[model samples]
Target: MTLNTLKATEAATLLLDWYDRHHRDLPWRVSPPMAARGALADPYHVWLSEVMLQQTTVQAVKAYFDKFLTLWPTVENLAAAETEDVMRAWAGLGYYARARNLKKCAEAVAREHGGRFPETEEGLKALPGVGDYTAAAIAAIAFNRKSAVLDGNVERVISRLHAIETPLPAAKPEMRRLVSELTPSNRPGDFAQAMMDLGAKICTPKRPACALCPFGGSCRALTIADPETFPRKAGRKEKPLRLGAAFVAIDSSDAVYLRKRAASGLLGGMTEVPGTGWTARRDGDTSIDAQPFAAAWEACGTITHVFTHFELHLSVYRAKVAQAVACAEGWWEPIASLKRQALPTVMKKAIAQAIPHAFKPV
Candidate 1:
């Protein structure tokens, strides 16, 4: 075997052994609190939390996860909720796509599996938004089946163990393969958990706790005395800048009019102010050609937010409405209750700026 293969093999053994002893007690890892009234390690809960945890920190996701469980309680509950409710529930949590997928996946399981989560990796993967890693995780953790799981955590652990210098995105396939090789046939759940714990606690992205790591002496990166540089990253490209206009309309009752986004793309299916697609702020391009609601409208200030590949500049406008209209599909949500409604961070910032001049902080 190659030296890379040799190191990965040894690292997996030591890391799993360390994990079997030092793993933290997270609520999601334990058996149900009580048989009569408790949540179990079911595929539904596993899938839900896994989906929420993507690109989100554990601390950030904790409150949102608890709130969701309180509101929906089960996959069927979430599946049955209106799309806007799901979007709002997912407010503040970026990556709106996951929230949409959560509902779609739940509904699919409900309709096709009679409200039961799929027990096999293949079955789980067939559901909407269930990727390879997610499918393997649910299949192993919930169903106790042996399926190879490779996520960012696993990739970090495997990359360091083997000291692969390839940058990410491109390096992922090989990382997956290396981890799959180490995924032992027995106790696959424990193995998966072990790798995750090792990544989060010891083989970290920054200055790894090599002294505490079980494979400290054997880790190729550690042996080379440069753990931080092992997982080399490619250079980043500059994000494009985009600009748009947003109309925040308020009625006599202090209710703000929010329109539901189209069913796909960024912030899809979420609530937002009436707006136009992002474009350059050049004079000719930004025609404010006011609609009927312009009677109460006034140009406010602007807010800026950046996405993965684009920057958005929103020119804010305020409008007043005496009577509500069924302007497309949306809610006439109270401005005071906007916090409860899920607005994207950008739109929420715009609303906070648009708080009525009378009530605006003195």
Candidate 2:
């Protein structure tokens, strides 16, 4: 097995050596020096961080990771955690289903597996939300199993090193197989981390620092003088813009009307002000007529938030009413306590549009 023309063993060695010197010091990962001294990250830490890191940046996940560990210091603690509390902490993370599934996976580990994570890839995959990539990652990083761990960073590194022209999705299988072959039996976990670090630091999507790359001597993309052009991706289709309206009702004492969202769709199990259903069409309702309850609803402004599959435009409205109102399935959250609620980013944006000082620094 070889990476381009170099023997796979040699390629792994070069990458590992570079990693020992320059690997990133991330919150969920053990440093190369620690790994060299035979330390590995806890399985719970690895799993939680992996789930949080899905489609999120390291910078974004750090605070959330720290918050989670502080709240539920162990897998059993997270399993027994109130789902509402979990959702509240996961408000800004965007992908709500992952939060739900994270709770489920934790419960499964706590109850079914005796609070110990599965050590094998297949065993981990059997857990909820643990797909092939996540399972492989947990097995390698947490259990030190010889499993192939290929995330986005490693994908770029492989696509460039082999100059594979297959566009992604179609190219992923080939990339996985190549990574499996290059994974060393001993220190396999460190080897996997090294590949990821090299890709993140040296073989970046933009102007990569080829001078610092360990694989520069053998990278087919670099030899061809256009490394960035590799890992070619198919064009993205334009997301349909869905239009709706949101109502922000405030009481005499400055509390905002908010309610819990249904627990099974976009922004599931989060909090939001009343809003019209998002329908995909240019003529979908975006007027004050779509308000949850009638008041002297005054139109203020519109806020647009982009989701993975669609973009949303919400026409925001606010009205102040007497504090002696009664409502079922909702609450009047004081403006000071709104930040602690499980309001998604879109809802926060809508609230901010209605009340400019809604999320001001305390």
Superposition TM-score, candidate 1 onto the true structure:
0.85
Off by over 4 Å in 2: 31-33, 279-284
Query: TM-score for model 2?
Result: 0.96
lDDT of 1 at 30: 59
Clash count, one per candidate: 0, 0
Model 1 residue runs over 4 Å out of place are 1-13, 31-40, 279-292, 321-331, 356-362
- The alpha-carbon lDDT assigned to residue 343 of candidate 2 equals 95
lDDT of each: 0.75, 0.88
Per-prediction TM-score, please?
Answer: 0.85, 0.96
The residue-by-residue lDDT of candidate 1 on 1-362, one tens digit each, is: 33354554565576667865788666566542332143237566678778887878777887888888899988889889997788888988898988888888989988889999888899999987789989999887777677878888888877777788888989988987776777776567767878887878878888888889776566777776587786777888887777777778788888888877777787777778777765332311233553325546777788888877778877777877777765656668876677767678888877866773422433
Write model 2 residue lDDT over 206-313, tens digit each, in one string: 998989988767888888759999798999989987888999999899999998888888788889898887744443578878878768889998989888888888
Q: lDDT (0-100) at residue 219 of candidate 1?
A: 71
Error of 2 at 267 (Å): 0.7
